[model samples]
Target: MNVKSGSAFFLKVIAILIGIAVLAVCIYWLPAAARRDAIERPGDYSLYPLLVCAYGVCITFSVVLYQVFKLLTNIEKNNAFSELSLHSLKLIKKCAFAVIFFILLAIVYLKVLTQFTGDDPAGPISLGLMGILATSVVAAFMDVLQKPLKNVLDEQLKND
Candidate 1:
C-alpha cells in the first residue's frame, strides 16, 4: 500500500481501538466508577443515572467514530465523494448533535439536582458544559465539511 492507504489503515485501526476502549469503559469501568462515587458519598445515588447517561453518550461517540472509520475506508477505496461517504458524514453530524443534546440534558439535570438537593454540582455541571461545547464544535465542523462535499457529490451525480 502507498503512504495514503497506510495512513488510512492506521486511522482505521486507531478508530477501532478507540471504540473498543470506549466499550470497555462503558461496560466495566463506568459502573465501578459510579459505585465508587456512591460509596464516597453514601446515600447519594442520584449520580447513578447521570453515569448511565454518560455511558450512553460514550456509546454514541463510539458509533460516530465507527462512521468515521467507514468514511476513511470509502476514501481509501477512491469513493470519497460517493453517496455512501456523504451519508456517513451526515450520520456523523447527527451523532454529534445527539451528543450535544444529551450533554445539555445532563447539564440541566445537574442544575436541577443542585437546586433541589443542595448538593454542589459545580464540577459535574462544568464538565457537562464542556462536553456540550466540544460536541457543538464537532457538529459545527461536520456541518461545514459536509456541505461542500454534498455539493460536489450533487454535481458529480448531475454530470453523470
Candidate 2:
C-alpha cells in the first residue's frame, strides 16, 4: 500500500483502539469507582449519577470516533470531497458540542452540590472545565476545517 493508504489505515486502527479504551472505562472503571464509593463511603452516592452521565458522554465520544473512522475510510476511497465526508465532519462537530454541553452541565451540578454540602469540588470542576475547553477547541477546529472542505467539494462539483 502507498503511504497515504498506510496512514489512513493507521488512523483507523488508532480510532478503533480509542473506542475500545473508552468502552472499557465506561463499562469497568466507572462501575468500579461507583462500587468503591458505595463500599468505602457507605452513604455518599451523590457522584453516582454524575458518573453515569460521564459514561453517557463517553459513549457519545465513541460515536464521534466512529464518524472519524468513516471519514478516514472515505478519504482512503478517494471520496474525501463528497457529501458523506461533509456529513461525517458535521456529525463530529455536533458530537463535540454535545460533549461540551454535558461537561458544562456537570460543572454546574458540581458547583451547586458543593454549595449545598460544603464539599470541595475543585478537582472535578476543574477537570470538567478542561473538558469543556478541549471539546470547544475541537468544535472550533472542525468548523474551520469544514469551510475549506466545503469549498473543495463545491469546486469538485463545478469541475464535474
Each prediction's total of clashing residue pairs, residues at least 3 apart in sequence or on different chains, is 0, 0
> Model 1, clash count?
0
Tell me how candidate 1 scores on lDDT: 0.87
lDDT (10s digit) by residue, model 1, range 62-143:
8899899999999999998888888998898899888887787788888888899888988988888888888888888888
lDDT of 2: 0.89
| Pairs clashing within candidate 2 | none
The window of 10 residues in a row where model 1 has the poorest summed lDDT is 47-56
Cα TM-score per model = 0.90, 0.92
Candidate 2 lands at a TM-score of 0.92
Error at 9, model 2, angstroms: 0.8
TM-score of 1: 0.90
Top model by TM-score, which number? 2
